[model samples]
Target: MKTQTTVRRSKYAPSVVTKNDLLELLNADFTRECRAIYAHAVYAERTRSRDEGAAARIARYGQETVLSALVLCELIYDYGGTVINNLDELNAVLNADRVADPGWAPETARRLHERAGQLRSAGEPGLAKRIRRIISAKKGAVPLAALVSGQQAVAGR
Candidate 1:
């Protein structure tokens, strides 16, 4: 079985993404999902049984985040995009404060929704729907936040 891969094949990636810019958006979404994985893991750890039920839920969310990443990898592979293996890139930006803070969850979910919409417009309705469902189900894992008035939230913030 041929298991190894490298950037040499990146040039083979399809250019169908040009018009819809789906790949770029998906890449950004993947990054956010990765950050969520890290953040949620921290949440699970620090939650410390403040509420036994809530703690279990938080830990489950971390698991869901892992699942999302797996699905995302499949999507990338299907679309002829390169899979990102260096998670350290994600870890570099996620600081102790951000990991412990649940505030980023709502924003993360929003970005995923936006990407799913783009995926649909780009003729990827099934993938888009899958993304939506995964995101919706994981909302509890994400911390709820009140939207800021008179300001649009920036992605990956």
Candidate 2:
């Protein structure tokens, strides 16, 4: 049976989200992570010959995304939600189209942060915290999303 929870938009107004609703968001994020994994893999392979160091770094970011997806799976099960993997559908986009521009990752991270805040307000602090932990505030950090997505350069090129 699915359960619904309330999140306070304000003292006077509250919104409700069913467990399936949460699952929908989680699954969507899972799909996104899968896409990122594919994109990073393509990028890593493409950059391997030209810039081995960059390729390695991109590969590491892809690994981190895998870890993040696992965390989301755990959250899904814990909340009585289903984990769906639509890798085939996610792969429909061309490999070249999959690669993220430098700004895309950070913007995506910012949106995730917003979702985390919503989860927190909806009495899902643990899940929210897990999501938040994946985001990095430090500039030029390890995760590809945060590293290349940020505005500043890596200091020494």
Best by lDDT: 2
Q: Which consecutive 10 residues in model 2 have the weakest lDDT in total? A: 147-156
Q: What is the lDDT of every predicted structure here?
A: 0.61, 0.66
Best by TM-score: 2
lDDT of 1 by residue, 1-157 (tens): 5556632534423334463367666776677677766655554554454444544665676688778888888887787787665557546345634644445766667767776766776788888888887787766444412211101132223
Residue-wise lDDT of candidate 2 within 66-144, one digit each (tens)? 8877887887788778889776744524643544655656666765676576677678889888887766531234544
Q: How many pairs collide in each candidate, listed in order?
A: 0, 0
User: What pairs collide in candidate 2?
Assistant: none
Worst 10 residues of 1 by lDDT: 144-153
Provide the lDDT at 18 for model 1: 60
